[model samples]
Target: MKPHSLTDRPATLNSRYNRLALVSSPRHLALLNKEDADTLVVICDWLLWQSAVTDGWHCVHFETALIDNHAPDPLDMDIMLRANDWVWLDGVDHTLFHGVSLGRQFCSTAQYIVSAYYRMDLALRKLLSEFSCREVTLYDYWVDRYLVSPDLRHLIVATVARDMGVHFDDQLDPVLPGDPALAAAPSTLGAPPTGWHKLAKQCGLALHGYAMTVMVAVQRRLRPRVNRPLVIANWNMVRSFLQSDPADDCQPMVLAPTLPKTLNLLRRFWSANILPCPYPSVGLTQQEREQIAAMVKVYEAHWSEPAEGLEEAMRRFMRASVLTLDNLLPLARQVKSVQAFLRRYRPSRIVVDGVKSPPLSIFLELGKAQGIPADYIWHSPLAPQNIRFDNLGCESRQEALVERCLSWGKFNDMWLERIGAACSSVRVGNPVLAKYTAMKKSGGGRDVALLLQLVPAFSDVRGLYLSQYEFFVEGVRQLNQLGYKRVIFKMHPSMWREEYYEEIARRFELKVEIRKHGRFEDYVREADLVVGPMVSGAMLEVLASGTPMVAYFLKPSTLDSTYFDGLNVQSDISRLGEAVTNNEFLDPAVVLDLYCDSECGQSPAERFWQALSRSPL
Candidate 1:
């Protein structure tokens, strides 16, 4: 049947019984014929359109079915109706399920329920409830049928609203009135004249500073006055935080920082206002700042730093108010959103972690310009003045530049002087390292393990393939050649669908095991050594266990950009054999003892909290 647009569907209320009857029998196919199939198509189309328009969801037509094979036996028509109502609930993508599952409770219950809706609703509700928020409003139109229902709509709406602690308002009003030129003319009539003039006025900045300073100022401002501040620690930092009493009220919010999308989603749902620390505009350059300021609200001339013509722009156009410790340099594309959040929340402080290079310095300068205090949580201690040669293989030009600039600018001394000059103090800590030490000693049994992470081959700029199946095949072959037996080949978690690893294992006639369940540490403990490209986390964990590590650098060129540079990056598989025979491994005592020492061993969490406590907003 040809696809039909839902906008043309006529509005009419059909009872659940009638709708179910129409869809339940094979004769319903004739109904499509009687109404030119367009009617049914229109109804379906309209329903999808309404849902999408109401909620920020995308829905697409799958296939027309005379009878749902997945429908329950003895066919409870009521349940079928409820299931149908729920098929598009919350605008969740439903392409995964082959067909809808119908049951008896759906029919007689009068509580029109969709299994998919309930599942998603429960999961989302539970996830939101864990966070401290006044309320969460899920605006979507796909559930219009349920919303219009007298019995089920009210109950579901009320239940969801109460659970989320917020009002659930479904605006059925069309985003754009009518259609085409007629609908758009009304909006244009009131639109501002001279777009270029408005654009010019929008892109202006007032102040600039070092990125690190902005981060510190922001962090200082965000220090919780009442309860303990939430410290976000990944699996690697959880144990360390739990062991140390950083402060009486400090709460740990354990989360992996790797998933940017998940973090963005979480940030959207959070209620707390987000404040972005301004940094010196000098690092951003005039053109870059102009581009940024055009989209965001630029706060001007608040602070002065050593950089030329540098300033900060406070963005106020974010969908969610999120106080991100992550750098805003890469997210220049979302400057409007960032500006939105800043404008709405006007957050007092911005907490910044991992500000080691120019980006960090730029953020700090920007925060200072914005008049927002910044607090920095440093993972590694300040590199000594003589340690310039230490970073011999860093591929990032910005990193190299920062090192050179700081050296020329005497930034290390200035930074230390600034640390003492500022109201707050610096913290020396490595939360991940601490967690690894504790987990290894805890005697956690082996379960799932990541054996190897294949590094992609790099060529010219913009030519790196993320997946290197061929390299992985070569690595596996090399491992077998070295008398290594019974090794479990674990592909990166992100590449589960790629079956290349599985196929290669089969072809090699190797008796290697592949794991798919349980804690990754279990595999780490069972295995003797971790062999892969520059996956620092695995190496760090294995080092904590005092297990041997053999890193196979894909190429010397590839290692240039990795953190492994100047830190024993191996180029050949032969190194693995040499390390095993030579009993070469990083000394846990030396590494751990460095952190254990009074100079660098201080708990970072404690130092961070103390700094926050001392900051004058």
Candidate 2:
């Protein structure tokens, strides 16, 4: 069955149910994103249209991924008002997380995933008791919070999975030890997909970051006041911010999600050597902690115990739930906390990172209200994506939100067109990558850098809308057949095994080596040609660094209209080997067009600082 589209849902609602909650169907969830304004408009438009025709029953929509902790876009707010909605609940961003049983205790992808929503469930019940909701109707699917029945026990209508013959399972199934067993290191290449669940196991040190999460939560807790600073959102922005010249005298105070994995990456800044200067944290404050603790207490009071083996795990899950969902009061407290932090620190400017958490939009909202200069950053490239730029996509909303933008060179014109010439845009090649790609020395060897993504979403719909991991066996097969002897497999940080390259070599019988340790510049310095999927920002940086590139996509239908006209790109999943062997993407002239809009003679870091420095204090 096709995923639910605007025209695909049932035309009318059943009058039997008065209070209805329109939870995002998988199809709708797949199409909508909290960060994209146009996506929000499209989704809200559909929900409002549903509300328009419905009878006496008042309806609310639950996106589950959005935490609209502050004022929304006027138009989006208007639509939601017309639709009369709930929201993408805070701490309940189920789209990116799941509950995993680690030993006797349980943990989630982030502290705010499936576990917390369960606690919020009881809170929701308590709140619902105040209303006259006899039997609430839900319009969602099994893909939402793993346990979503208690809140909407009336009816679950319009789930796409049900049409496809998948039954809803409510069991809080614990992840077994080595349950997603390692893919057989393939002796001779005769195997099928190892099933979806098995292929979706946590790669490496997923849970190990818990300690760091706590440590940072305590050590760099939010301060009442920070020294002269520039406020940035998410760890990715911090990564880019610190990559510039320290003498430039810019201190970055980052607002990051307090999650284990994120905390682990943030802790690495001490010795990163990439940072020319020090940065501060945006972790929870004492008040915020107290509020969170109280929320946990109230949430736990409701769902105190669980069945059998899930006792301790369920308790942790509840704690984790409040850590993620829309408990309103605590989130409002967090907003106050941010307000206090901003008032005290008074960052020279506020930057809203679009690629990071959606609530970070709060920063932009606050910036606009307080007369502080706030801007947005695309922070990456967009090609080989499901989004079609030449035809339609929702990125233009970002261009409208900010007065100025810091973007990749190749995409500047697109943003200008999307937002119009009124918005000033600087074609700053990704500063983080620019710092990494610095010191690139020309090499006289024939070696290739093949990037491997974790989940290839175009090829597999089960994964999130991200692509990076497809190459490896297929790419190596192609390159080796093309007589390229030396190849380096740069593993994404999310990969679990340290010896993953060795595993690849052993499994696929290739002459490829893994460059496990080194900065990106080190790898770039050693390679003659950079070959990877076009969907990555790093590849663009490689092109800007005067290196030739060949970008691979799964198929032509999945390819977006890339930036350049004569760019070296091939989209043939069936004959990837032929595409690589024939040098279908080999070009030096294409690199000229790539860096043209990506960067100027000035370093990206300098350019970014200049963009932020546009409106002076």
Off by over 4 Å in 2: 1-336, 355-359, 383-401, 415-426, 436-438, 441-444, 447-451, 454-470, 495-508, 514-518, 556-559, 562-565, 573-583, 586-599, 614-617
For residue 584, model 1's alpha carbon misses the true position, in angstroms, by 2.7
Candidate 1 lDDT, tens digit per residue, 358-421?
2233333344445655544434333211111101212111111111111101222343343222
Instruction: Report the C-alpha lDDT of model 2 over 123-208, residue by residue, as the tens digit.
Output: 23432333323333233322212333332221222221133232333322222212122221111333544667445534323344
lDDT of each: 0.34, 0.41
Q: Model 1 off-target regions past 4 Å?
A: 1-348, 353-369, 375-427, 441-450, 456-471, 474-485, 495-497, 515-519, 558-569, 589-599, 615-617
Residue 601 of candidate 1: its Cα lDDT? Answer: 45
Highest TM-score: give the candidate number. Answer: 2
- Angstrom error at residue 559, model 1: 4.6
